[model samples]
Target: MALTFHTGEVGVSRAEVTSIVADALRREAFTEALVATYVWGKGKRGTPRGSGPATLQKILAAEGLDVALAAAVTVLHEHGSQEAYAALHQQIPELGPSFFTKFLYFTGKTLPPANGPEPLILDRVLSLRLRSLAVTVGRETGHDPDGSVAAWVWADWNWSPHRYGIYLSFMHAAARQLAGTDSWPSDAAPDLLECALFNSAWEPSS
Candidate 1:
């Protein structure tokens, strides 16, 4: 089946962005550290092109890991045109060039697992604090935050050529956002991988 394309420019407001970013930070305590990720999935297998990955590496090689980490998340939140770009470029020849490639450059290499699921084909993460704010924004904007935001981590191991590379997929609203870890005792002690902006408003399709 052919895919549908969204015409006209899609824009988001700065106030909304600030609200979303702030909420993501407030409700959820910023993660002190998250294990580096690695790609593991099915799809084309080829070393990144000339100076492509290298350029991205240098551009993103921030002095502080925290800045790098935040930038990573920000990229996802902003340039999440993976699906759209793929579909549109086919029709709009000019847009087909290297949009995806550039986007990937902005994103860095996925690191190896931290020590959780064995075949963690994908890992979608989000800040618990952001959940409330997103929910609030969604409500105020008449848009569904759950529908708009979420993480997608994927790895494919069945592609014809490259069969052993980590792939990240945007898993829509599929993370479990908890409070904190167990050993380290504190007020918020639950680990949240994903949390919906507002649970009451969202109902599962039965």
Candidate 2:
């Protein structure tokens, strides 16, 4: 069966999704925002929660940027292992789920997996969109839509280390199929598939 995505207006071809993703990737402001978030641990525009960049700067100051970076790398290396994730939370008790996840996202973007897809941003918008996709993909693949993986990613708000590993696997498969060709745009990257999905879900229909 050919893999496809619903563009919220009509069923969009993979080629169209790839084109939208590619165009988004080429935007200077988009790339700059990602860069700023990765380097500074939060962009100047602030988080989805409305917390300012200054808050992130304060956390970095308190945690020691180098130490925080090392911890973040360790968490990614472990592939979001429960132990590693816990250790990070313990190290920075003040960072709630939203901020911690963002921190992980930025670090993962900075140092992507050597063998697999990079860690995806899991903000509220993306998470909600992914939840919907999980149901669609699960049904298409004949998997239980409300199973552990889906529950972990879609139902639960807190990051589950074990489930996140499963979620990443699903994301990799979906992204590869969506790319539709061997030569996908380098700048776009597979992780941006979530961005494309988010756009489909929330962008005003034209």
Candidate 2 lDDT, 82-163, residue by residue in tens: 3344445545534544455544454454445444456654555556666766666776687865555655657535556554
The TM-scores of all predictions, comma-separated, are 0.19, 0.53
| Model 1 Cα shift for residue 127 (angstroms) | 26
Instruction: State the local distance difference test value for candidate 1.
Output: 0.27
Candidate 2: regions farther than 4 A off:
1-35, 38-47, 61-66, 74-90, 94-110, 114-116, 135-153, 181-188, 201-206
Give per-residue CA lDDT, model 1, range 167-199, as digits (tens). 222122122222233422234211112113212
**What is the lDDT for 118 in model 2?**
61
Q: Looking at model 2, which ten-residue stretch has the lowest summed lDDT?
A: 1-10
- Candidate 2 global CA lDDT score: 0.50
Q: What's the C-alpha lDDT at position 166 in model 1? A: 17
- Stretches of candidate 1 exceeding 4 Å from the true structure: 1-24, 27-29, 33-63, 81-206
